[model samples]
Target: MTRGYIEGLLSSFPKLMIEGQQHTTVETDAVRYVYQPLFEDMYAVLITTKNSNIVQDMDTLQLVANAIPEICQFGSQDDIVENALQLLSVFDEIVSLGHRENIDMAKLKAIIAMDSHEEKIQDIIEKNKEKEAKLELKRKAKMFEMQRKNAAKAGITGAFPSTGGIGSMGDAFGSKNSSNFAEPEQSTYNNEYSPKPTTSAPATRGMQLGRKTKGAEMLTSLNDQVVHVSTDEHISVVVNRDGGLENMEIKGDLSLIISEDDKNATSIRIACLQDDSIQYKTHPNIDKNQFNESGILTLKNQTRTFPLNQPVGVLKWRFVGQSEDSIPLSINCWPSATGDGSCEVNIEYELNSVHMTLQNVIISIPVESGAQPVVGDIDGSYDFNRSTNTLDWQISVIDRNHKTGSMDFVINTENLNSFFPVSVGFDSSTSYCQVQVLEAISENQSVEFSSSSKITPDQYYVI
Candidate 1:
């Protein structure tokens, strides 16, 4: 057996090895010893039966000699002890059941270094999830801090009520969660406050104005004041840095809440500027044909009345704009690096809407961490938040009186891209499609109803 031959060769290995010899093959009465010097004093020896082929044993010994240096950093006794298990695995790979395996250095190394593509992808996904969770936590904390400050400013000493959920806080404050950027630190424009109607009409009945429900409890408390007509419009715009529209989307929804006494209200007539680019969809329960021909929202069955004391969505419209002119506001950002490790950023905004006035416009520009921006010239107020590392430029209102604004600031950063992909949030008093509710008709009589329209930015950014 090979075990007996190995034991005999180990006993006589000291006498057989020479000091400066590179390799040797010695034969005893029963076994043969084939070994080559590894380093100064280490030797990789192979013991075989006397009848075994010396040429093949020498070739195998050469392989063992080459692999030792690849496995161990230094061919010292300490390295050999530390990598004993790995060396054993390599030896087993080279010779299985006393028969040599046909493997080269490239294949051997590849086998040792096991890599999986799926594992790498999973790791990347886990990292992204972790990043999103952290961002959400930061947003919640910022919202709570802003709420606390606003409460203090309003002279409220009582403890704040528990927010129903994380999302409820943003909804209560008239802010939507942005996917690509952090939430604004300050309170956004009050979306609940409806603008005064431009034209005068007869006094409306059973209508409550400037009243917004905070949460589920608030809604339950103000049940009597829930009868109203409201329109919500969300605009999302994405633009490239140079000049082009990446994407532009406009969505509008009409909601109605009627009191029990006004259940007889047959149809709600709406007037809107006709546009071929707009697509309209009515609720399944409403008459789609009538809405397509004339903007009248009514049920299919004449006998059945509208739902009482419950909110119902009647009409929805969507518009996808391919041209840049469709954007209500256009923002241009220019960042240039100075000779010093700093950058000068100039941002300009222009109102493209002919009649609509934008309010509470906040443009958030990213900056380097722990870097302060020196504002040279700004049309409106500006604030640099160190915690979030962003410089926010705020304009109260942008109408015909003030349709353009600019901001210039300098920060200690050489990266021009750091100041890019600006996030914008604003409120508009008019809808993009100019859709307006004219009157509610019941039994061929004009019904007194109140209507309000509001526009909010869903996702507006420049990259």
Candidate 2:
């Protein structure tokens, strides 16, 4: 259709146009045009052949128009101009080879999110370089410690032997010279030992560490790494994962705690394996919440339970926010090769930002049916089990607001699968339920609270 043809029809419907009456179609001899006014001075016009089915054609046109907002988020010429390249791709996907094809919303989003693998690979390179520098420093420290230990072995009467299975395992676990968790009043600035903020949280722009965020639900600590609090009752929480908290026996006085009468517990997760719940035993007087569809134990409209003795609850149930939430503790593994035929695996793992402290933090890595990994530099103690083709790492304790540990292993590529998630386990105590209302609200009560969570494949990735 000619511009004059549409202009003539548009002139007659100028009143309707000004009133924003969308979905107006003007038919002409050669083609039909459906117009949707976008902004003050611009519009989207979808022209179709006269032979095309009007309803189907118009619906497809609407779908294409709807997806524009998903891309630009607002209706402005600036939005269109800024996303020119991406919109151009969207147009192609909506109409393949100048013919309308699939109009799948999810597919379009996935396409946009998957931006420039080369850029991501470059980022990984930059991060790995920083990690390698830290590894070198660790090597120098190890050498210094070994020398000090040798000297002490001669002069000191009861010093640990140098030939023990762990050359300096005691030094790694609990040493005054080493960096440990900071007290609430204590702080560190711009040092390797400083506790970094949550690296696994959702990525954001212009987020500086320890700065107060505008309109945040809760003000995070510029220093403390123990717990994160929000507006929901000043609730400070940490789920412990000490000593892997496995196959434990609890013989304490049983008391189930409750919170505000206006609120209820939405999640109850034990970080042990999901299958281990079969071993759980609770009292008949307990008013326990059952698991939701997503596996969180959803509790509502309940008060404190009567006290009993001897209670046991094994870790079970998938987390309610499993897809969105990150692991409080995690592992990162990268497989690479040396110039020679030998291959190496670089691994870094640490505690995430949360309220609880994890004691006896450990990691388990599986090897192929028959392969030995040679790893030195004792940041933590390691034990190999030939029967299971696995290596177990034991760190005595990982306290709140602490730095991470890294190490390298030379392994045979044939001894491993393409990739597998490293499993981590720990034990921890509870953050009690003690909240107070300002007004003539209910009085606060303190009850012991213990919880934990584990993520398998924490964040999924390929080798």
Candidate 3:
């Protein structure tokens, strides 16, 4: 029953044309397909989430259209139109019979929306036809005398009367498609409408072919990765992928850990899969050529990383963005050979230790599966190494000793050299520190040592 309904739905949708490429598809359940009519002989498709089965069939058509926009090169425009009409017809049949029980108010709304969108598409297509007619008229006025000669060359089969104008052979075959010898010269810029702008802008030239577009809806393409985050206040994004990780697959729940010292001082640690990459692309509903600050950052949203073997990297736990009550973060990912690697980062901040003004600083830590540490208490001597300016807290630890686990340290950097001699602090100027976890597991459940860290430096350091 579901299959039949799907088939019916697909049978009703129109075939979308972009350039010469065509898409006649029903898409799938829980999916949205957009056909934008661009300039003459041009169109585009925006396919959003879909059920697995539908994705396979629809993706094939999408890949072809994306690779080459000239759909008519392989077949006639009539063939493309017929394909679309057949699909839409099937949809009409299904809706009429009511085979699917889930068809309710939402589905009906979508159908109405689809109808409205198609109407707009048809309007664009008509506009393009009118523009094509004007260009054809100009072509007809060019060589009035050569009409009979070209008519004779084209033969009289289906060749309507030329009316004694340039409308002889050129009208039958497109001016661009004119026989190599008889074709007239073309200028660098013809009046032909440049197809509708990509998801980056609005239609500046009124030419419309037959494609799906988005005015404000989410429009996108395959293989495009991005991160969308809304913290109930400010929205932030990071949209670049190059010498960086690309495949960003969110397996489970992830979050941001923030610590605040009163209302003024705040520290943040974003504990997520670090080395993921996403293709931040422009929203399909928008145009590519329009001047929009929105589009400028559309392609690059957020950057987060985590290394597989090392467990962490430079920016694993750093300040992403600040808020009144919380901090926001985002990341993108694409497929990579390194097993979707990322870097884990941790940031520690201690304030006013000299005066000890701020007491009871609240610390927040977001733990991941297979990565939580067993907290252990240490009983040993605390000694300050003035020679190396370091503080050493020695403790006795053993495997299966009922005391193997992780520990958190709160220390000040300024007084390090005063008691010991190292550079460590709780201020913004302090460099990042490493947190090491030592565990003892038997050969049956062996002990392993792993570590992760976060750091801060001038942006120039990367260069």
Worst 10 residues of 1 by lDDT: 186-195
Cα lDDT tens digits for candidate 2, 109-130 = 5456642222332233233334
lDDT of 1 by residue, 297-394 (tens): 88776765554433457788998988888898999999998989888999999988767888888898866555679999999999875434568899
Could you report the Cα RMSD, in angstroms, for every candidate shown? 27.5, 29.5, 29.7
Q: Which candidate, 1 or 3, would have the higher TM-score against the true structure?
A: 1
Worst lDDT run of 10 residues, candidate 2, spans 228-237
| Candidate 1 collision pairs | none
What shift in Å separates residue 297 of candidate 2 from its native position after superposition?
Answer: 17
Q: How many backbone clashes does candidate 1 have?
A: 0
- Which prediction has the highest TM-score against the true structure? 1
lDDT of each model, Cα atoms only? 0.69, 0.43, 0.27
Model 3 sits at a Cα RMSD from the real structure of 29.7
Tell me how far the alpha carbon of residue 336 in candidate 2 is from the true structure, in angstroms, after superposition.
Answer: 1.1
Error of 3 at 150 (Å): 17
